[model samples]
Target: MTLASTLLWGVAHLAAERRRTGLALMVAHVLMLAGVLTVFTAFSVDLLSLAVQPRWLIVLTVALVVIALAWTGVIVWSFLLVRPPRSDTVGRLLTTTLTIALCALVLAPTAYGARLAYVSRDVVNSLFSTTSSTPVVAEDPWSGAERVNFLLVGADAAPGRPGVRTDSMTVASVDTETGATTLFGLPRNLEQVRFPAGPARDRFPGGFTGSVPDTPGLLNEVFQYAEDHPDMVPGVQKGKRGPALLKQTIGDILGLPVNYYAMVDMKGFAELVDAMGGVKVTIEDPIVYGRSREGLLPPGTRKLTGEQALWYGRSRTDSDDYVRMGRQKCLLNAVAKQADPMTVLNSFERLAAATKRAISTDLPQELLPAAVDLAQRVKDTRIRSLSFVPPLINTAYPDWSQIRRKVSEALSHRPSTRSATAGRPRSPERTPEAPVSLDATCR
Candidate 1:
């Protein structure tokens, strides 16, 4: 009778002649079931919406613990009330042991679910606390917004380096409704970068000029530059002043409002890749790295380790930054597509730890639900890319007018169809124009 109750939730109580208790348990079970069904029906299309809400996560965690305790208590009470009164000593011992085992089996998954929820809340709090300065719209985060622009940067703060340098910079402008994303890649060596209206503009009227001739002013140095001179951006918070400056400068360069910035430390980035079980990438050619050019990853479709994938994306020995940019795009696409829910959930703890260690952003926690929903939508669509490399634009003396025009054109048009040149190296003779589909290019 107790075992049956574990399945039906109230069978044992009725069998034990407890009419009131049996009816109450059955009603509670039915009500819980109905609530679950209603919630699932409402959020079936966007299940990630629930996961992203910290309040719901906490509530669910507590509810699971309560459910486990109540269920186990009922199981014990039911067994005591319904057990055979004239059973032998050995039979009683056997039944008691079996009941204990059954309770453990029921508690196992419930406990695990609670643990995951707690860990998720911890990570969310650590990364996206309400301490952020950016204002969030409570009801609709994306209302009246045609496009939301984010600055995604990869900064390298190596062992011996004095300060961090943002070597990889990409602006992702996403359409609010369609989830159509356009990625604009800027070379690290791009010089004469302008700043928007701020103290930074007051200091650098003629664009960013390096303090020293040997360390020429370039796009990559913007972060450390702001850090070194905090007086220039006094309104910004202390630790994040650098990224704030870079965000404004990049926004000015693109002629778009860079709404948020997410930066990942290059050193910790390897751990993130490993946490996701490493990313599968298609290599088109041999890439070399290291001070002595000792490391080489050959061409093929391969699942790369953290270190290998880092080199594959960052190395510029035989190739230049432009080629490296394309490879980075391909690697990002692979990680985004391949890191499915099962893999992430299985390795969630490690992924969360690595993410918190590596990434820094200004986005508020309240916006995470909307961000998660948008990400799910983005996964279903194609991503487009525009690289500002040599021949297309001169890094030394870039035309700000032409750069903005190209950006406007790319944003205005639909992404191109799959080209025969997808996954192939760009030909020197090929015409330099327009954004190409990232899916086709990475495929």
Candidate 2:
């Protein structure tokens, strides 16, 4: 419905409800919900997002919540603070009417603020997100490489934590000519990588904070030691936090340059999946883990909710992060497969209502449609992924030594985004892109 129509309907419904029952519980709740929807729909970036994280749209929500709560509180406080005056019926009605009007007063500012915040965030993201690598595109880079590599990072928001831990790491390689995408998962717990010595340890027997000088087989201990001792000087700042630092750490690892970076503030992922009608992920093994948000998930292909999907990607219960990396890949595939552009467009009216409140991306508005189309074209396409976990990459016997080695390899290997793709071996048929006019069997 048009924003106007929806608002009119909500106002009419609220009026009728008030007439039937003054401040009745159900009546107030119904009105509140209607008002929320109307307001949210009125300010969404694109109505096509209902199939995604539509419900928690930030701007309108922040506005409406403040107004709604304030209204309720005021009405209750007024009743408690004073006796109903010998006021006429008209007076009471007028008071209630005025309160309702004030509640709705949040609409304009809420929407305006939400849009501003959304655009502002994108600006910040673009400014800070330096191209770690060239973008993977349909055409080959002049370097003559067919594959393009992109990095995925799982960042935590815990205060005092060193920037972001490379908890979940994955790399995707796309062959522009063949339309194939392969993903590699890197285990965060890989052995031998030296932990960045917080400021406290900079003067230690080792070297600088991030230097890997002789810190073999004791990688975990470094972080543990740094974490355990806040008294240490290098350890000041309560833990090195700052997202950009961790991005550097990852760039230090895989040897390939990174181009595009996406950081989902730890919440948007799960909500986004469910908002997209849930994803269909194939479970390699049974997941018995449970959380308040996501319950039990069996070992087969199943639809997942936001919390459930989050738990599935992030949970390290029975398995290590290496295994979880695999699960993360599955979830990514599922969401991409389930992206029903048609459903999204059809429900644009409602979905647009929901988009503003819940999610933001580094991609620009002009880029979104193209990204959507690009994602859609690759939909249902088969993808394969690899993870250089444990023995394949980290051969250190002790976890710490192994961690250091892994860290070194990660840093040494870390380079440009395209270099990583160049590092990978592709079938001879997987040459650079051939023009559409070229014969398919020209090879």
Candidate 3:
């Protein structure tokens, strides 16, 4: 925390990494300290312009961050000290100077990293509905003011992995003044979602629909349906129409005009978890093995691989897809909860590479830095949780008539249909199908 403690830790970590530390190392460390000052002073001014701290606190925080950077920089130099002779006195001085200069050079990467992170957020946001992004749509008809709603959807449709399913879906609603961000899971099953763009009557099946196509196949089905019945899922191009319909469907349900969307491919999710040193999740139930992806998932707090994690998110054999949707929502929360900002920072390059390779977003590029800034400040209390899996599907009594009743009630923002029948989980009921209209979803 203090400068001395930071310096000591830096030296100690260096020593631990390398058996030896000499005058050259010491000099390198000092230069590292200076280099940190130079780089951070330059970057923080640009990245953190919207700090809420009082003037004094802001100044103090900046000072501390610079010190931390210096400490971190010293850690980098420590690696060199462990190596064989970095150089003679003159050589060491030259090497130290060179390393310092390298830090200056590395600043480019930091700025570049900032830019990449910014772009990533923007792209994801923009991807939701290209026309505009009004992500915060939250309103409890029972409550006074309208709530903020954010359309959160994860499509496996990233390039190269086209026709992938909607692996994750949730509507995030926040009370603007109160800053209560409630996340609700949208059951992949449910049924009809009229799209605004291509098909005016596009339909997204509920996850539990036993005969409905898998996500991958469903993607094609939607596209084909769009091709044949474009009015059903409006705003869809026949060639790659599924994504368009799906996006529209998601937009309609959230109530908040659809603004931003983020799609993470299978590889991206796994790598992101691993990149964050794996998320620590408290698994409450035992995940049984299943086909299509018979992943061996052990219950408890264990690190999940790509497939294992996917299956974990997708597993609903016991409770069906509704519960699975809840689990996926938890995984997202866990990912954000356990997310290592530093790891994300340090691995910005890696994350960026993965971002381009495995994610697609439509958010404007410039809004990125602000998003990261907002994200950094958002503590757990600011977030709330909800589920789109209506109470009807929670049990076996979800007959078509009952299910349709639930869907209608949901659209009208009324109480769930199954409250009188099936047991209710302590979750806000989200209609099975609430896709966005093309006008509201995109532009």
Candidate 4:
């Protein structure tokens, strides 16, 4: 409405000045306005669906660029047509210079904005291009569900490795309305994880006991296993062969339907962190880096670089997997709390490029807008975390029923005294060995 009123006023003013110049200016303004409106409408109307089609996006971008350039030319021509004739050479030269400067001042930002839009569109196209082979669902799988579950996998793929292993496995279950999120971290070494009754179950009757060379059939191996033995789950979609199997297997174990899966390459994860200007984390213990464990990350609250943060989350030479999981959760919480909308908008180009290179997901493109809204809501909500490790649950032979019960209990939102003590001050030296709830505001 504002843009419409402004366009109307501009046309009126131009028309009142001179008939010929006004007509020319009005035509140019109308074309530019129409082009701008069309682009905006495209963004608001099922943009995610359109974004997956690179060719259409490229065409639209080119058209907008052409219109912008032509609009500039018309504005300059109209200015010359309307300007008063100067008798002296110096006066005429000064008038022309000022007019050009004025035009540049007005058009510079518009051109810059158009360029950013083009870059953003290209980033979206690139993100989808790599994952084009991933299966597309007919409709949102969790359309009617009160809660949505996403399987987050951190793949560790070093050079020359034949296949990658999902070293980090977490299920983020979020309440659709409240945006209350519960992060359930499953131990990578967890064994005896059952699959739903079907061909998957038929193959692994005793819950994934098959061995792959030196590696055992642990929970983390599910993704790579599915990739290697695609024929095992013939009914599953061809594009989502690996993630679908892992989702099913993980879903059966947790007694919840996994709606989607997002796999992050470890290297790309570091780049993303760097792009976000590094995430602030409270390191409770010293973290060792590299296979030699020679490089040490001192403990304290500090902003860590991409390399430091990655090793801090994945390092297990000096610490155990449970501790690493805790650190990873802490890093994630810090990112969630600190990477506000403004921060992301400021660093959008870099972040988008890094994300495109690092992340792969089975999430449908149509649901991205809703997911963004949900993320905004999540920023205001406190995130509760639970890790299945050690005394909590046996990794060698996990009690599937017990784990499911825990997950259900956590999601049930049972009244507890823990919520009251969540924000209370605690001694710096008295950090809990295992924290059920994390303070989102903690530095």
Candidate 5:
């Protein structure tokens, strides 16, 4: 009877013939059940808003603790009432054991819920704890922006490397209403990148230049260049100066304001993929990448482990940077579409740990709910991609005006006049040559 009280709340009291107490407890149980149902229904409707709020998370934590304590107290009281007053020692032991088991069952879920809430709060605070010193393009939480542009960077700073390199740079421009997105890929070797009007412009009036035979003066070198010349980005923190310069340079190149940047360290990126249980991609040819270019990843459509996936997207052996860019885009699409809610939930802690170590951004904590909402919208719509490579635009002497015009046309939301894979041999894993839906591009 006392064990039955775990669900009935008053079973032990009723069995002990305490009619008034039993009836009162039963009424309280019914009220609590109804309240829980109502709260859950509301929670489902406003989940995005509520989940990201630290105060709301605290409230949820406290509520679970209180419920666990109160419910267990009632169980113990009911056990005491129903236990025989003159019972033998063996009977007392059995009854006590049963009560302990009942209490354990009640407390387990409550404990897990509280921990999950606490972890979520910690992650949000750690990821988005922006200070007044951090420079921002917008103060509001995305209230009136027609389109928001985010600079996505892949920083390669291997263990023995001297400095970080901006190996993979892409801009994701997302439509506020329709969730349509256009990805602009810039080659790492893009030279003669013009700096915007500022200290950098004054320093490099004739555009960024590098040594002829030694250095290519590639766009990727800009990050470390800013770091080396801290005076170029005065008043900014040492870690942030590189990204600040990149944002300005990329924004100028694309003819759009770069709102915020999210950079992932390539070394730690492998860990993130592993945490998500690897990424699935179609490999048309074998890829070779390692310390001495010894490791090889074979061809096929399969789920790749962290190291294999990294090589698949970035391998340069017997291939060019332009081909690698297409593979990287496909990898992005696969991760976006395959990482469902249940997979995330099951691997929540590992994923959170990997993300904290692998990624950094200037996004504010207050904008998390809005960002999450935007991500859901983006998932439902089509994503278009365009890369500035040879024939489209020269990397050594890029036509800035033509690049800007292409960006404008892509964002105009007009129908694409050219076929996505036009004028190019169709490979099994090739990304569309022109701006088009990723669905048609990715396998």
Candidate 6:
């Protein structure tokens, strides 16, 4: 309606006998054309591809909004101040009222769009400003051929604890073109985790053999140990000593290059779930939480709140660590499948706040466009998961070669069953097997 009205008004004024009115109408028409061009430019170009700082993004957003408001004011002024010649009192009154109404219609969407854009920019700036405690280098742009691997570390940090321990660790490797993802869950208790040929390897020639009383020579402790003794990994970057060392350690163990790491605070995991209005999952077994054994989450498909989902992923009162790992994987798959754009947009502020507080990653902001594309591909593809547990490999003394080969096979081969979707029932054969379909487990 606004566009049509603007067009009609432009034509009327362009054909006006008075020079002042015609000139004013031409200026207004040009401003309208400029607005249309601005919108087109926004859609055509990757505005975020520019390597601008967060401060610049803020400045640009504010400038654009100011310009929009100024243009709106100009539009109103041009229509109101520029009077048509030989107009009667009632005619002039009606024209002024119609002009105001038209301007309001045009300004409403313009202001709303500008506000949304500003909010989005602010959110991205907030996320980008959240730097890790350590220095990290950015990776080269992805070529869409090789796999991009992200180390998803779930950190369990309790009050009064000396250091944080990564309770759950998984490598999510996505195929560049296909979006097919393979999740390799590293057992926390996995012993003799070899470090790559470096200072780290020289320090522990026989692999990471250090241990505390509770978790003896476990894979998870490597992070805390490295964090405490940064000198062990000589020349390691500050604020990134732990994650860098762990990334290398896990990379060497899996025989795959770990591109990035996202450490999620387990304590804030519930907040993240709540931010997304909770995630729906098909619970295969009864999940028990709390010390009294009374907080029971019964089996069946159900939507879980933040606290319930956290326990669903982290609890091991009724089961063991390995079982808990599987549950975590299921929860992850469910979140990935269910947290679509609409869901996140609906609770955007909450989700953004939760994410900023809970998560930290070394993934470069420049690669977000590629990451988003890859994520879309992953959503459509079958996500296969492989965990080094039980018959597959002993956590006490894991066969490193066997583990690597399983990771390789899972990534190379397509699952025999149909591509898994969230909330669907799984076949009996697909239940908790090695290279299990995450969709099936999360179903």
Q: Provide TM-scores for the models.
A: 0.90, 0.45, 0.54, 0.76, 0.87, 0.75
Return the candidate ranking by TM-score, descending: 1, 5, 4, 6, 3, 2
Model 1 Cα lDDT, one tens digit per residue, 1-443: 88877766788889878889898998887787788788779867555666667888988888889889988987898889877665577777887888898899889999888988988888887887675465667566765576799999988866676788898999999876668888988999999888888788888888888677657899999899898898778977777889888888888888889988899887688898999999888888888856578877888888988888888878888888888888887887788888898999889899989998999988888788788877866776777778777787899999999888778877766443334533334334334454443323784
Please tell me which predicted candidate would have the highest TM-score against the true structure.
1
C-alpha RMSD for every candidate: 6.2, 14.3, 12.8, 8.3, 6.8, 7.6
Write one digit per residue (lDDT tens) for candidate 6, span 1-443.
22332653344444334557657656765886787688569753334443124454566556656655665554565554454545578866777787777667767766665555565666566555445333433432574235789999999866565678888999999866567788888878888888888877888898787754644667878888887787767887666788999999899888889988999897688998998888898888888866467689998999999989988987888699888888888788789778886897688677767877888877766566566656767878777777778878888788989877777666656444333432234333323344543323556
Candidate 6 Cα RMSD after full superposition onto the native fold (Å): 7.6
Instruction: Give candidate 3 misplaced runs (Cα > 4 Å).
Output: 1-148, 156-162, 176-178, 193-199, 202-244, 251-256, 289-295, 373-380, 390-443
TM-score, candidate 2, is 0.45
By summed lDDT, which 10 consecutive residues of candidate 4 come out lowest?
1-10
What lDDT does the true structure give each of the candidates? 0.81, 0.46, 0.49, 0.71, 0.81, 0.72
- Candidate 5 per-residue lDDT, tens place, 1-443, comes to 78788787888888888888888888998898888998778666467667887888999899889989989998899889877566577888899899999899989989988888888888778777645343334443565566799999998876665688898999999876557778899999998889999998898888987445656678998888888788889998898899999999999999999988999887678887898899888888888867687777788889988888778877888999988888888887788778887888777888888888888888777666677778877877767788888878889889999998788767765332234433323324323343432323778
Weakest lDDT window of 10 consecutive positions for candidate 3: 434-443
The 10-residue segment with the lowest total lDDT in model 2: 434-443
| lDDT of model 6, residue 287 | 83
Candidate achieving higher TM-score, 4 or 6: 4
How many collisions between residues are there in candidate 3?
A: 58
Residue 281 lDDT in candidate 6: 89
Candidate 3: deviation at residue 395, Å?
A: 9.9
Stretches of candidate 1 exceeding 4 Å from the true structure = 45-47, 85-87, 131-135, 414-440
**Candidate 4 — what's its lDDT?**
0.71
